[model samples]
Target: MYTTKIGLAPAIHDSFIASEPLGHLLQSSKWQEIKDNWNSEIIGFFDDDQLVASVSILIRPLPLGFTMLYLPRGIAMDYENTALLDYIFEALKKYGKSQKAIFIKFDPAIQNLPENEKVIQKLKNLGAKWMGLTAEMHDTIQPRFNAVVYKADFDEEKFNKKTRQALRKARNSHTIVKFGRDELLDDFSEMIQKTEHRKGISLRNRDYFEKLVDTYQADANITMVYLDLKALLIEAQTMFDQAQKAFETKETTNEKKIKQLENACSKAKKDLSVLTDLVQANGDIVAVSSALTVNFGTHTEHLYAGTDTDYQKYYTAYLAWFESIQYMFDRGAETVNMGGLENSLLETDGLLKFKKNFNPKIEEYVGEFDIPVSRLLYPIVNKLYMMRKTRI
Candidate 1:
């Protein structure tokens, strides 16, 4: 028998933690720290002898003692199993009722493969209400995807003249691409701040970005493009990590320790080799973007991409994107998601227009779905929050 329960404490789901499908972006220590510090409840589903899946729902208080649950890139489980899904949701419903939560929310990490339309339908059939337009991306923990998913096989013939031209231009441009851990984060922070300010949006504080970099540095890819003489222009990141497997440092003094040390040395040597390659470049960075790749057995998401506007004329940002697409293809990725579209459908959205140029077949994602516990109070609280946002 499988058991489901609710509690503030972290679940003892070591097995799921060892092999659950999610990226480091969702599993970063900083994100976890933030969740833990905030009011949260762990919804764990367990098999007789093992904890199979779990979702951590972080709650925020609302007026009149109401609360809302945010399932941040959550619902860790076997989505193909309807029985498990129902079991999990039932547990959540019971728990929400007990907590007197206003509503429950989740945005599952389903990919665009097998078509996103089907996934949306499934969610509705499973008793989850769709909160946003099916065609428009929603405001949720994860960005709603309008991605380009490619097959595993490579097709050189599919490369159009424009794509080739972009690649050629990037190679011919006197620029260097650099990759590192936290070495360039402080430098990148300046670039991020500049871009955010231009977009009339506030960015994560310097400390938050630093903590993010530090937490995911082990597996994150920090990519930057520099022009002649290493002038920063584009700083795109292809951050990724295996969330299913985490290294558990063991206390040992024998062959195990020796092997662990050897592995660390080998990794350092390999990383240095790559760094050496980056240092040899001599171009100033003009535009850069970063993405987190989350793998879920049969799907993956190229999550989040931001660029610099200071050098938009030079089109360094295009070059960076071209390089990233090629990199994803080369890495045997089944689909290279260009990511979601925000305010792009508007006629004046230039960034959205640029992404559409990649010839991506745009589709909507299953956005935030809420299971309301207190139907009466949930709407009132939600309206107040929306009103506040609108005023801002």
Candidate 2:
């Protein structure tokens, strides 16, 4: 019989997940550190004393001494193997019931492949419910559709037009910090708050930001992307001065050098004009936008980002994303998970449109499923949950 263990050492979980293909950050123990707000457990399933599957399950306390077991982008395992999934879920249900959990909610990262349909049908036959793909935001705990950047043959000649533009602009301009200073976090949080306010979405607290970076520490897994606008302004001025001096030089011939000088002067002037405008608005140096990425396994996840409301015209967000893509790609990452977009190709949300710059493939997960400990309480709790969630 297969066996399961709870609250195992992180090394055990790490080793198991690392051996698998592209373990999600949510399934990683690193996420356990960041999600300190919830009670968590590292679970492992074994066959003949050899580890077969592992997951990080978060427990949320509910009313009347009951609990809800939630796995965010988790139950990370081989979805194709029905035997493994059947064994693991049975163990999980038994353990969840023992822990007074009313239900166990799972949203695996499995896409809706043709072969995957067989697995879904098998799960249904085994009494597992399926939430059919829906574009509604509240239909699932996480977005059903996500933008995934796959590792293709790196062709320098054929880049997405927007990717090319963002890269060129970033390369020619200011600094892109991988891990910015602590002081920059406050600015980043403020920017996020302002953006969230404008968009009418709920905003996270500042401590959430601090804990995420601090939990990841200075590891390559957590990449913080930000721009030093002051540095760009100063560099632009220097380039302008150097270009002007070179143009006035006597040694310069009226050939290709003259054309080069003219082009340099023109670019420097335009950059100066843009930089000067930004500097005048924000002061000596300021962070216009910032993004935090979590690198785990073979993929880098672009988790959260925000732009200064005033500096949107400068396209700092696009630049930040471009540099982040390059950073992960350079380090041999297999994919860049650009995060979620609502289902539906016709959706014109700005978030989806912005992430579309990278020409990402839309990965659709088959929403969430719930395994209830008590069938009688399931509908009651779900109705209450829907009511409360809708109010949000």
Could you give me the TM-score of model 2 versus the true structure? 0.82
Q: What is the C-alpha RMSD of each candidate to the true structure, in Å?
A: 17.7, 5.4
Residue-wise C-alpha lDDT for candidate 1, range 143-256, written one tens digit per residue: 665656565323434656665566566556565666554676655566567667778887665576555556544434455665542421112111111111122344456887
Off by over 4 Å in 2: 153-156, 173-178, 181-183, 220-281
Model 1's TM-score against the true structure: 0.67
lDDT of 2: 0.75
Judged by TM-score, which candidate is best? 2
Clashes of each: 25, 0
In candidate 2 the C-alpha lDDT for residue 241 amounts to 94
With a 3 Å backbone cut-off (N, CA, C), the pairs that clash in candidate 2 are none
What is candidate 1's CA lDDT for residue 306?
53
Alpha-carbon lDDT, every model: 0.57, 0.75
- The deviation in Å at residue 371 for candidate 2 is 1.0
TM-scores for all candidates? Answer: 0.67, 0.82
